[model samples]
Target: MSRVRHREAVFYDYFRQSTKIIVQAAELFDRIVGEWPSSKPLIPQMKELETRHDELTGSVIDELNRSFITPFDRGDIYSLISLLDGIVDGLEGVSARFDIYGVNEMVQSTRQMSGLILQCAHELDTLFEHFENFKRDGVVLEKVKRVSDLEDEGDLVYRRALGEVFSSSADPVHVLKWKSLLDKTEDALDNCKHVTNVVHSVVMKNA
Candidate 1:
């Protein structure tokens, strides 16, 4: 292989690895939400994923510092990695809160949002693959739109969930705890959208 191809491969691999971590985090989130009310603490699993993501982020930054040419602009690469990491961080925060609040049962709204978050992440997995071909490929644009649509769905679910909590729950403390947890879940979904936007922005700038 030529030296130039090898260098470009490094950038591709870094983006792929970063997306894998985000996907893994999303899967873990689905698991935690599925096994909600379990006796075990799920925060540890999230913490592990978050730690791995941080290490990957650092490696990407190190590579960026060393490389003279990148597949995309240096700023865009950094922004994409950081935003992807933020998604994991946000997911980890929600898991930690679940443990801290001693949440024994998962509400339907939370469950619904979790599913949407997973779907959005899955769309991103496809979206990232087209990064190098962003200028001409229309499929990447479709994936971006799908992620954006899912984010809107997440927002709807979040609003309905909050309304349900307020109208039905008589305990103020319970309401407070669930509200905070739901808000964190929404935040994680927003992070996913942010990742999608970064991909879209890179395409637009280069198109």
Candidate 2:
């Protein structure tokens, strides 16, 4: 095959691998939140996944630098990887806070957010599976909408979580700690949307 054809293949593989990394990180986030205190020991595992994602992102950047052509706009590829990386960072931040804040219990909102994050990740996985097909087919747009809808649900959970934090008479220090964790959870969810929006734009531009 020509070098041009090889470049296309390499680009596809890199994007797919990056998407897989995001999904794995999301699964780890779900497990960390689901198990909470018992899952404290898994923070290192989550950290490892974050590091792996960074490596994947770096690989994508290297590929972008060397390739004469890209599967998508180079800037879009960079932005998409950066936003997806942020999602993992957000997840790792939440896990780190559980230790830093000495949190012993998981709040209902945290669980809700965790579930939402997982759902968003799954939806993104679906979207990524169809990213290359978007120009020839329309089904990919539905996956984009699916992630966007999940983000809306996440926003509600985030607001309710914050409301509970401020309205309760919990210790001020406890309130601060919970607030930070909830914010991180919300940020992760939002990052999922940021990624989807970028995909949405790419699809529209190409479609």
Candidate 3:
């Protein structure tokens, strides 16, 4: 195939892999929140997601190294790949605490945060599909914004839940657990934002 053809193919694979990474991270976040049973089982789920991405990254970089041509700058490709990877890494770090810290059940706010997290993941999956036909598909950009809005909503729920937790919960240990969980939820939303930011930035540069 031609160099330009090879380049597009490489970028396409990179973008698809990155999208998969983001979606899996989001799924893990949702699983932690939505499937909470005070058992800390979701930690494994999150770890598995990270492992899948690790495998994807190895495959991508190996392909990149072998290719005679690429679609974008090698640095840009590397940076973009790492940026998406960081989101998953950061999310897993946050989740790891659940098992290490022994945080079992969480509050209503935590549930709200998880619900929003799941929404972001769904939206992102849609956004990536739209990214494929971005010019031919104006809906992708709109959906990215929708994910942003959900994250914002998540922020509000997080704050209010924390306030309630502080006011109603008396156990110091409980407070600590809820506070940490709240922070983790917020960080996950931030992760979603990072994905959106990267996608929008790429669109600006290319479009």
Best candidate per TM-score, number? 2
Q: TM-score of each candidate?
A: 0.92, 0.94, 0.80
The CA lDDT at 142 in model 2 is 87
- Please identify model 2 stretches exceeding 4 Å from their true place: none
Model 3 lDDT tens row, 1-207: 876786667666666766776677777676775666653766887788888877777778787777767654566566656656766776787678766777666677777777787777778767766665655577777877997899889879988998998999799988888788678668867777777776676667777
What value of lDDT does candidate 3 attain over all alpha carbons?
0.73
Residue lDDT tens for model 2, 43-93: 998899889888988887788888879877889888987898898888888
lDDT of model 3 at position 90: 64
Please rank every candidate by lDDT, starting with the best.
Answer: 1, 2, 3
1 against 3, candidate with superior lDDT: 1
lDDT of 1 by residue, 148-177 (tens): 999999999999999999998899999999
Candidate 2 global lDDT = 0.84
Stronger candidate by TM-score (1 vs 3): 1
Candidate 2 vs candidate 3: the lDDT winner is: 2
* Clashes (N, CA, C under 3 Å) per candidate: 0, 0, 0
TM-score of 2: 0.94
Give the distance in Å from residue 136's predicted Cα in candidate 1 to where it truly belongs: 2.2
